[model samples]
Target chain A: MADVGDLVGRARDGEPRAVARLISLVEDAHPRLREVAAALTPYTGNAQVVGLTGPPGVGKSTSTSMLLTALRAEGRRVGVLAIDPSSPFSGGALLGDRIRMGEHATDPGVFIRSMATRGHLGGLAWATPQAVRVLDAAGFDVVLIETVGVGQSEVDVVRLADTTVVLLAPGMGDGIQAAKAGVLEIADVFVVNKADRDGADVTVRELEQLVSMTRREVRGRSWRQPVVRTVAAEGKGADAVVRALAGHRAWLEEHGELRRRRVARASGEVEAVAVQRLRAELGELRGGERLAQLAEAVVGRELDPYAAADALVAELRRG
Target chain B: MADVGDLVGRARDGEPRAVARLISLVEDAHPRLREVAAALTPYTGNAQVVGLTGPPGVGKSTSTSMLLTALRAEGRRVGVLAIDPSSPFSGGALLGDRIRMGEHATDPGVFIRSMATRGHLGGLAWATPQAVRVLDAAGFDVVLIETVGVGQSEVDVVRLADTTVVLLAPGMGDGIQAAKAGVLEIADVFVVNKADRDGADVTVRELEQLVSMTRREVRGRSWRQPVVRTVAAEGKGADAVVRALAGHRAWLEEHGELRRRRVARASGEVEAVAVQRLRAELGELRGGERLAQLAEAVVGRELDPYAAADALVAELRRG
Candidate 1:
């Protein structure tokens, strides 16, 4: 029941409870969510947002833990958002992941949260950017958005990041499948985890070849993606991965791609919010007799879906 | 391009090329999509929609083929919409499945199409029901919507069906995992495929228990979902599966749930079309300087995302 301003003040003062409360509001789509977002707006845009993603069994959780340790060793407060888009039903599929990160559970400098879509209206698109804003405003130096599975929604979530790290293991499929999944294009830094395994060199070579093949240029400057090798379970290659992240960040800044990326992300976030608002409006209109009648007519084959939609849109406009 | 009315007339006369062309228009979100939908509306509401979904390796393709043969034997035309929400990148992932169903390629009574989301604007939501309408209007007696994977999007696609069949194979996973994935609640009929394989009995029993434990009643009538056994590769138990589908359809009509379900489906179709229209309008607004300016303000932290969304929605209304 505390005021929004008080919560934001506490969150900025390193209070994890206050930070968690703000994100809970975002997740639940609380009525006062707009007020909270407005209150936290001025303090955001300071944290570096990085995205981590890969297919299942790629040790995404382990690699994320290693990165957390490496970042914390440098005295930087970190925020972690582990997103599970696949487990919309249980919302408990990530419990094992949270348990694996138990070492940092008690550290005040590290804050971790797992999010699921769970049949929400706008799904991840509506909640994720707001959660990132909350973490950024909470004074976290780095915000890592780690997602499970390599679906389109996962790619959309990772695209909100300034830098994206894609993890792959030796035996997990070939680099071709990853390319087919569109991960190769979104990855700013590629990590071949479990580098001590048998096929580690092959994975590294494949990723290097793939990255070299797909040359991308932004604003007349091209940044060749670097593929790093890591044994995340042993924490052997965390520093190198962190260095690659830093290099990509610096390159983005120098080329002015960072602001452009942020603007694009903001544009998507704004559009998702606007669409969600219109969806809500549509639901309200449905609560009345308008949508039901149109649906009845469509079911009766008296009105087509597009014509019904046109009528509904006209109603929405009239409102 | 030929006239949409001419295409609709050809489709009604069982010309597969016309049917294919109309569905292509739906998939591409063509400018004349509304004309096609409007033209096809009156002839719809006759085909029975059956949705089949489960995890991979469940022999969904084989079962669909078996059902196709069974329905063709009864002198009925059947249409199939195979949805691949996972392989959004490689639309070619389902090429093998399509080739597997090659026996029906020459049959005039059978029509098959595989659809992938592939970065579309409305995704499966906006395109699927319209595709179903196209098939329904093309004089197909039964429309089968078979979806790959058990993700939330797959569930949403299957919800458009009058009777939803959830396929499970022996040794795929336990019933608990299926329940956790939320497929247990959506099944009107459960098929335990590969029934000759080991553990098929246990899987069937587990599903029966799960179905019985979560009994659902609509309009004071309760229909217990039947779990059927099938060795789809050998074409065994296809009759039982077909019988189960008929029984469920009969029950749906007797309880008036058929009309209710169709109305709900129409409501969703209309809502998706409306939302797609609004999204297009938003895209137009984004092309102007208004959305870009608001996004810049959001990135600069001068205006929050919610406020930016409000401005965008206001602009959308003004349009």
Candidate 2:
């Protein structure tokens, strides 16, 4: 019930409660929260958003936690937005991800939050990026986003991250199928997580082959994607992963890809916000009578959906 | 080099070459395609868009072909939009789904086309609903959209379909995991495809339980969510699937959900078109400078993506 402006101001002034409240407000999809988000936008753009995605149970959470620790050890602030699939029946997230980050909860330099898909069709809960924006504005130096590894939609994390790391476990069936599905191309760096598992060598070989296949297709001569193997639980390969990330940042700079990615990221966010606004407006305009008539026409095969949509849009435009 | 308007006109006249040309024009992500699509919109709304989605190798294409056959047998004309994952290497779709419908290509009443995701970040290819509109205007009574089962983004099917059937194969790891992931809730009718496989009954029962759980959460009067078992290869349960669809149509009418779905569907199409248009325009206006700048800032860690995006939008507004 607090004024959103005041809440945003307090958050900018380092009030943790205000940051927490703003996150909840955005997550709830409250209309007023958009204004708060917009106000806080000016203060964002300081956090390094790293996307962590892989097939389910690939130790994505463990990797995220390890990264968080590494980031903190380097004397940098860290934020984690762990995305979990929601339970449709209860409309609540299992929230198991936060448990993985238990060590960092009490650390002032760390902020960890778990987000549910929240009925958004895409793997991302619509509010996930908005929440990320809030943290960035709050001065977090590193933001790690963990997606439920369901594939393509999960790759959307790339649009929001400065660097995207695709995690893969050893012995997953059909490695080519997974790569062919579009995940392989989105990775700035690949991590063969759970390397202690049997057949890790085989998975590594398959990933290398897939990467090679992708490299041949790329038009440019400069970009070289690297696949790194990691036993995330034991932290055996965390330093290499970090080094690969740093190398990617350097490559992005040398090639100017980082600038392009930032522009694309911005464009994506603006478009998302614009679409959400349009959907809300359209929903309000669809009065019961028009909807019922259109439904009847569709059921009776009297009108096609496209025609119905034209009529509705025409009506909206007229008003 | 023909104008898009001319191509769309030819497509409307049932010229296969024209239809194919128009689809290519749209897929090319050209600005003129919006005008061409707008011209085609008036003829759209007549086709019933049905969406088919499930995990890979669940036989979505086979099931789609069977449905098309049934609809054609009933003297209804059908249009098929099969969206294949783009080959990451070539940025072109393999378009092999037509193989599944090899039996129906020559049927006068059945029109089948395959669409590649075409670098669209979202699962449903950006050109999809527009292609469906073209098909609708071409006088197809039913439009079936088959999406690669990559999850979240594919769920966008529900936004585009009057009836959405989620296919599930028997023994797909954990049925409860699938159900809890929100796929169960999007389905109007649950299908246990590959019913001949072991654990079919178990999958069916788990789906029923999941649906019942959702029903309880909504606190609505108890109504059983129907599950149809189908071995799509042999067409053993195609008729039952058809009947279940009809039943869902009837239920929608009774509950007014059908009308609601139509409005939602129409609005969704409009939003898709509007967003696509806006993105194209934005792309042209940026002319690659803004994107390049943002991507660079991201790599340098000099700016956070969210803030950079907010700034870009501000800059765009100023321009």
Candidate 3:
């Protein structure tokens, strides 16, 4: 086994292989995860963590790459964490993001890694904060977390970031979906990608109306959700996205919401870890034995599921 | 303040008001949830739980009403649970499902209710199985759960049902998304609604190929997902859909998969409940006290999040 301190030291020295190996440890749930996290904690909080998400085929990868280029031109070291919520059917999936971002493979100042979240162990929500810390500590000035805007868990991952960007496309199904569900509140900044496509103006107008409707005076929410347009494939309006991100960041900092948001993030992480830990401990306390009995009781209609669950909780607590 | 047994009794007698109250308790996470579950336990497992899901604009509600018509034609009492994963921005939202199913409002043999998952307490995944039990015990011969096909929690709700129907429209962009994600694996039957539209055949063929690819001899899975066509707006092809459901039901019973699926469902419910219970318990025992300290420790970089999380777990165990 590689020495944890050595790996951390090499990562701090900006060694790419060491950074990759450390992330591997994070993904594999390595035994030395506690040690690795402790060693890397001090170097965190320096990177500006930004998350980008959108429905599939909305050019999320294109926007991410363009943002990377714009950020890189400013001489900032950037790291990208692209995650696909792993599905049951697709065993060895070929992600579109990987192919889309292939041009940046040889860029030394840029680090990119792909994660497939099978929700094993603590799952993506747990693994991501730790992984972000790794990249943050490894001297990335900006860390970008991108996911296909599908699944609750995937959306939850972006919530941990300092700023969240929700992307939409024109003349497709994305605009209606964003309207149907809870997409309004999640977007700190919205980017209408594929701006060259037909009905782009309609999509923009529709989004503007939704944003205005959300930031109504009755609710008393101060921060306005800004919708920017970008043809990411052509690198058009990429600068506008970066400007919008900075504008949101400034607003967050000015309103003292950044500190509050970070605290909430920290509190959430602690709770998530605690919950996952308790779950594992309970699983070892003859949980399967008791669970089988309780489940059988439920199936036989002898006891309600709530009662069985209460009994199981008591058993684990006693253990 | 109604007695749990009384409410269950009234619900079993097809009292719409009582049924509505019981489901409201389910939604509100009423303190009497445990008692309600116990009272309704024996009367469950009689209803055929059919889950219908598809991407937005795929006509899930339309098909649900049509299916309700077909099932009611056979003199079977039917209940509907249409859930919208509640968005943070939309409070008191007017759900499309409720409006679409409005025509069946006066039908004595049908009960349709809507649930919005704000993830209060145990979340929709934990709450839904119990809710289904309530409807089942209320003497409904069939319970149909209709949800917009987005996010993992929404999809997980379908897994609790006996048969899952994945709906698709001809022109809307659901086919690619379903193919990209794991929807193919979760589907037992596919409904190609809006069959009169152009490209309906292509959509059917696409689903057929994807479903076939999933059920290879190497996997040793014998179940083949059947695709049925429907023009739900005009009530065309509803009988074919009903026949398809019955065929799948017979297949499930003959193959002994029904009992196994229910057992698995029971087991999952038990686990979900245990996890939620443990989370709440851990929240006690000076829960907020240790959480703040741990969050501070993690933020200060004195301890890595993993180590801080480990320490928090230790504190909870000690409590």
Predicted candidate 3 versus true structure: per-residue lDDT over B2-66, tens digit per residue: 88899899999889999999988977878788899889988888888899888767788888989
Q: i-RMS values of the candidates, in order?
A: 2.5, 6.6, 4.1
Candidate 1 residue pairs in clash (backbone atoms < 3 Å): none
CAPRI verdict (incorrect, acceptable, medium, high) for model 1? medium
The fraction of reference interface contacts (C-alpha pairs within 8 A across chains A and B) present in each candidate is 0.62, 0.11, 0.51
**Local accuracy of candidate 1 as per-residue lDDT tens digits, B210-246:** 8888878897778899999999999999999999999
Evaluate residue A283 in candidate 1 and report its C-alpha lDDT on the 0 to 100 scale.
73
Better of 2 and 3 by lDDT: 3
Worst 10 residues of 2 chain B by lDDT: B85-94
Interface RMSD of 2: 6.6
Clashes of each: 0, 16, 0
| DockQ agreement of candidate 3 with the native complex | 0.36
Top candidate on TM-score is: 1
User: Which candidate leads in DockQ?
Assistant: 1
Evaluated on chain A only, model 3 obtains a TM-score of: 0.91
Q: What TM-score does model 1 score on chain A?
A: 0.97
lDDT of 2 by residue, A1-319 (tens): 7876787788767677888888887677775765675577667767777888776667877888888777778888887777654433222222666765688877888887777665552235257777888888888887888775553344565447888888888776636666766666677888888888899888888988888877732237456678898888888788888889888877776776666666566556555554454344444564635544654564344555445545655554554
Q: Tell me the lDDT of model 3 at A81.
A: 92
Order of models, best DockQ first: 1, 3, 2
Candidate 3 Cα misplacement greater than 4 A, ranges? A13-21, A24-32, A54-59, A83-94, A118-122, A148-152, A167-184, A190-236, A247-256, B86-94, B168-184, B194-224
